[model samples]
Target: MIIGIPQSRAFKWSYRAYVTLFFIYLALPLATVCAFAFNDSVFPSLPWEGFTWDWFFGTEAPYIGVFHESPILRSLVTSGVVAFWVSVLAVFVGTCNAFLFVRHEFRGKAILYVLMLLPLIIPGIILGISILVFSSSVANFLEDATGLWFDGLRPGLILVVLGQFSFITTFATLVISARLQKFDPSLEEAALNLGATHWGAVREVTLPFLYPAMAAAGVVAVLMSFENFNTTLMLVGSDAPLTITMYDRLKLGSTPVLNAVSLLLIVVSALLGLVSLLLQKRKD
Candidate 1:
């Protein structure tokens, strides 16, 4: 028997197959990683020994869990602190820049706008190196001139925050500016006509409208700062962030603890995403 050609049906089936394969390809590795987190193996790779929580909470010999791991825990703390500060600072500065760029047209408005975006165009490594060099030069100058040493400006968490901020804030500015573009200018004008001062209008009317966008930008800043490796690696001093610690550990050897950390991160990220969705739903 000869089969009849069904071109349209075949095309639809082919399209669905492609999409299914695409998603499976993306999800399979992550699924494997999560599964490996529970595997009771010295190594994170295949041939699972058994299911165990040794990697997550063990305080004993070879199976010492991530919680008992001091260096990794310390690096995790550093990542959190840096991410928190970076999120706060980036949102504040980026919101200010977004308002300035959207609301005003000064003499150098176009030039300043381009300058603000330069950070996004630049590579992270270059930004990190530039910041490190600039800070070192300033520290040296201050020491030579004032004869007072200041290690605060050196390569450390502060430098890491600054380095991440250099690009992250640009990201935030773009987000806030996009949201600001959709805003109706007349509302602010109406507030002004109703006897509200410029600052009052901005504080009460404008910022409330921008809260969702700012929150989203803040989330992006935290995630970026937490996972940042290239710039962070260059700027980090004696104390490293989670990404740096993970990299160092991989360089030495692989372990199930790494998988445990990855699993924890995935869980935290999922929780954050759920919270964001709930907030957005309420707003809607």
Candidate 2:
């Protein structure tokens, strides 16, 4: 009994230590980035010369310049546009697909589901290259067959949105479908029996319930779009997305300015989340 007691105690202690280390691995880098955002140095992550917001706003530091002057600002705008389109397109298409998948008893539905989810399992770099090659081919074929214009058959906005929409729509579908599955059929039947049209029933009763799920799914889709790097690199045009821009900078060197960018992203995302939650609560 004494020997077993020590062994069990050691196991428990070791498990606790492991959990602590795991959280540290996850959190330390984020903490470091957040701290360095406030650093006044030209380098994003350097020994603090003094506290400053020159990176966030602007300053007269030797190597450092204004925040707006940073290439990151342009990249940020590009990222915003991509994320917006991806989220909106994904939600619209995914909602319809999810409704069909949940409400209709169609043949080959399982196969369709598998195909929809295939991109989620595939590696992103492979997906990016595949998209580039496929879009280029399609663009050439269309141009040859019919005189129609397409974005420069390679890296460009059209390809970026298309590639992202392919997989991200699947994510949105899963989200809305999960919510749809919980719906009671009796509610729809009652509406129909009470002389409501099918469209009216869906508009008044079904859509309200799905609103929360749709919003959450959209947020997820946007976050995924914004953070995507491997895929963005292959698809984004000369106007680089933020992730690509950051990679280019890192090739040159990391900086406290990079941390400043990270900080801005974290803060902005958090603020948006908080605002969304507050509005949701107010609605409730």
Candidate 3:
């Protein structure tokens, strides 16, 4: 039986209706996309065309599936690479920030924390434009002053990673920091008292406690980076990521192949989320 306060029949029915509608709103589009992924029709939308594997496995010209779609495959690889690096760097820096904010007292700590959160408050498009302009300015200045050009300072994958990292790191820091706050200092102290160095104490005690949080943060970073569009669009150079490529393709027209790609992404994202939940449960 329910343990909460009693509710009227009308209240109960309304609440249930609200929840059902909310879920339908969220799931209907995804369900539609998944449905079209198997549709034999060239377009992603319409009356249910007869189901076929052409969108995923066909090898012919107009029916070329995702497996043979060179652009999508290459962009997928590029997105994966960018996500990997963004996750690594974001987790690393976020861990450091967590430690700094939680373990030590410092001047202007509140200000620094607010600054760290500024990126989250900023719109993605604004953030992207800001980074693009700033990087371009810096690159131009360096070339003019030093006569040495740095390609990394230009709009490229590196900038995309950095642009994504700017906000994603904040999320990582928040997750790890919440975990760190719950950790007892005595555990580290006890390790230190037993002749372990500070680093050793952290490695043996604190890091173990933080592993789950870091993993979660890494997953968040990877997802955010992989799906990022505005920032990635601004900083992207010759190579494009999956989201950018999909956007370009959508601009031309909607096809079942894109629905196929979306289906694959949905599957992958669900798997990642499931793994994260399992890890969290195991940790608990």
In order, what is each prediction's RMSD in angstroms? 3.9, 3.9, 1.8
Tens digits of per-residue lDDT, candidate 2, 137-168, equal 98999888899877667689768888888889
Q: Model 2: clashing residue pairs?
A: 43-256, 44-255, 44-256, 44-257, 45-255, 45-256
Task: TM-score each candidate.
Answer: 0.91, 0.87, 0.94
Kindly list the per-residue Cα lDDT of model 3 for residues 144-191, writing each as its tens digit. Answer: 999998899898999999999999999999989988998999999999
Deviating ranges (above 4 Å) for candidate 1: 1-10, 273-284
The alpha-carbon deviation from the true structure for residue 19 of candidate 2, after best TM-score superposition, in angstroms, is 1.7
Instruction: State the C-alpha lDDT per candidate.
Output: 0.89, 0.81, 0.92
Report residue 245 deviation for candidate 2 (angstroms). Answer: 0.9
State the lDDT of candidate 1 residue by residue for 159-223, as single tens digits. 99999988999989988887788788899999999999999998998898888888888988888
Ranking by lDDT: 3, 1, 2
Residue 253's C-alpha lDDT in candidate 1?
A: 89
Best of the candidates, TM-score:
3
**1 versus 2: better lDDT goes to:** 1
The candidate with the higher TM-score, 1 or 3, is 3
Report the lDDT of model 3 for residue 57.
Answer: 86
Model 2 scores a C-alpha lDDT of: 0.81
